[model samples]
Target: MVGFLGTYQVSLDEKGRLNVPAKFKGLMDKQYDNPNLVVAVMPDKEGRKDREYLIAFPQEEWLVNEEKLSHLSGLDGDDRNKMREIYAQASECEVKSGKILIAQHQRERAGLKKEVTLVGMSKTFEIWATDRFEI
Candidate 1:
């Protein structure tokens, strides 16, 4: 599969609900029987606050990654820490009426406001505050 491919401008409702782009939604439905997604705060390699964003992975895709993470040796501290951090902020959301409700903590971590943009990135998609999104 080519995976998700496109940039869609959207808005988050006051309650923190985001309307998934129709194309992305369609792809998810066609690719996975379960309409669930795992949303998490994307860590910035540069640790720049301005570059913060949230990433969403289809449930099946996330499960695949989780399976890999599960095999890591528990004796490795770094690996344990990394898994803890990733799982700590990850949220499982169900697509309902073409929308998903982003948790408040995830929204705040990404500095998401009213305007947001959804960028397709292969097996995942990203959510960025419109003002913070730069080509």
Candidate 2:
């Protein structure tokens, strides 16, 4: 699968299914097959619960991240625990028919009701509520 790298707006239906943009789907075809994606809800560090969002990463990329974290040494125990917590909270999901499911908590935390913006960062994608973003 191609690395995540762009942004697109998508509509979130009542059931929480949202389309991954066509371009992103095209990009997926180039880099992966039977693409299994992972989703994680990350809250802002500054105590803004409403500022949380979901992050999706291609399985391969996630594995790389996992490896990097696994190899961490000489780090404080608290920092390592935090990383473990993040990884444990992530969910493994599949991209089907160009769409993915955002968990209810993830939707609510991000204030995603009817619409969402899917942004592709270098190695992962971020889900932001339409209202949380400025066009």
Candidate 3:
């Protein structure tokens, strides 16, 4: 697969649904087999440039990451705790009417109000609070 490049500025509706960019949606339809996508909360860590955001990826790709995380969790104590923390903060949803529903808790974690900033990474996309992104 190629990269999920570019940055998109969008908003969530009253129902907490944000539209996926057309190009990214096309990538999902054409390249990914999974209909559902997983939204995982990425917390801000010390020395990290990026702020707290949500990471969204197709189910299949997420599963691959999940498998690797599972393996790492088994061999290390610190990684095990981190893995559980990340998994616990994740939520799964599919694109409907061009939008993906961000779970309430996940939305709250990112302080995602109506306005949001969606950034496309190579393997996954990130959703950020509009104000937070500016900071």
Candidate 4:
């Protein structure tokens, strides 16, 4: 399956638009079967030292994740709430003029300032703060 496979240093503008790495763009154009991407505020399960971040995935890849989430023990109220949160917090983003406009709330949730670290994670990628990403 098509997937991302590199680490890149990127940046976000004051308007919350991020400059996706060129390599990633090429992969999307040549290998991705999806029409768009989704950027979401992933829960910081690790609870890192104040370093919040978001995650991005090609539509096809995200569908796989969504499918898994749908099957998670939704019998409990907490599980249901978590599933609702993930779906509610995700945003559909398009590459416009070489950048993706991350919604203001999404940007804030990720604690992204001017600098960002976009790390490829197979089917998806993680957006981290410059310092938090640790290169």
Candidate 5:
């Protein structure tokens, strides 16, 4: 499957809208043909300081992940909580006029300021604070 690639530096407007790069946008249009996206905060896995970021997935791709999560045994407390957290933190957004608006809570959770970096990651893309994103 064709996937997103490369890094883009973007600025968040006062209203929290991000103008997605044309290359990535084109890929999304051609590959997914969807204007909807799912965004969620990704906490630092290594417990590193100031390393939190946000991940965006096309609606179709997000649904695939949701399907996988559905197979997990809800009888297990941990599995149930994991599903709850993942579903709770994810937000659906629409790409309008080549821009997507990041929710305020999500932006705060990711520590997003004015300047941000969008990094392509195959099926998904990540948004990181420019200062915290290391090469």
Candidate 6:
């Protein structure tokens, strides 16, 4: 892997599209070229509304995870229910011109409007709303 691996603050445009940090682009090129990537809007407890964060996973990786979930489907009962919840939130997105369009609901969920933070997470990357991560 390339040495350019970490997180950085980025800006989101009026259309909710975020630019990929240059360093991150190098890493992405080295790791993945798949046009399709999955951006998931996640929310945690405290009703914090995960609008500040966007989870990016390559479509291939998502598929691998999907396969794992598929295996769990065979298991009857509670396990299946849990996986169902996870699947319900997963969404597929395409990375074009190094930008990904964030869904409106996801933006609202994460409280992301304008500014965003791009975090590089080794295999994938994350986009966080500035307000939610003010330091």
Which candidate comes out best when scored by lDDT?
Answer: 1
Per-candidate TM equals: 0.92, 0.82, 0.89, 0.87, 0.92, 0.77
**Model 1 TM-score, 2 decimals:** 0.92
Number of colliding residue pairs in each model: 0, 2, 0, 0, 0, 6
Candidate 1 lDDT over 74-111, as tens digits, reads 78998887788789999999899999999999988889
Query: What's the C-alpha lDDT at position 72 in model 2?
Result: 64
Regions of candidate 1 where Cα sits further than 4 Å from its true position:
none
Clashing pairs in 3: none
- State the lDDT of candidate 3 residue by residue for 14-97, as single tens digits: 989999999989888888887579999898887342467899988888988988786774568788778877889998898886
On the 0 to 100 scale, the lDDT of residue 15 in model 2 is: 88
The candidates, ranked best first by lDDT, are 1, 5, 3, 4, 2, 6
Off by over 4 Å in 2: 72-77
Q: Which stretch of 10 consecutive residues in model 1 shows the poorest summed lDDT?
A: 42-51
Find the candidate with the highest TM-score and give its number.
1
4 or 6, greater by TM-score: 4
What are the Cα lDDT values of the candidates?
Answer: 0.90, 0.77, 0.85, 0.81, 0.88, 0.70
Q: What are the candidates' C-alpha RMSDs?
A: 1.3, 2.7, 2.5, 2.1, 1.5, 2.9
* Cα displacement (Å) at residue 129, model 3: 0.6
Q: Please provide the root mean square deviation of candidate 5 (C-alpha atoms, Å).
A: 1.5
For model 4, the superposed segments whose C-alpha errors exceed 4 Å read: 46-49, 73-75
List runs of model 3 lying over 4 Å from the truth: 47-50, 74-77
lDDT of 1: 0.90
Full candidate order by TM-score, most accurate first? 1, 5, 3, 4, 2, 6
Position 64, candidate 3: lDDT? 87
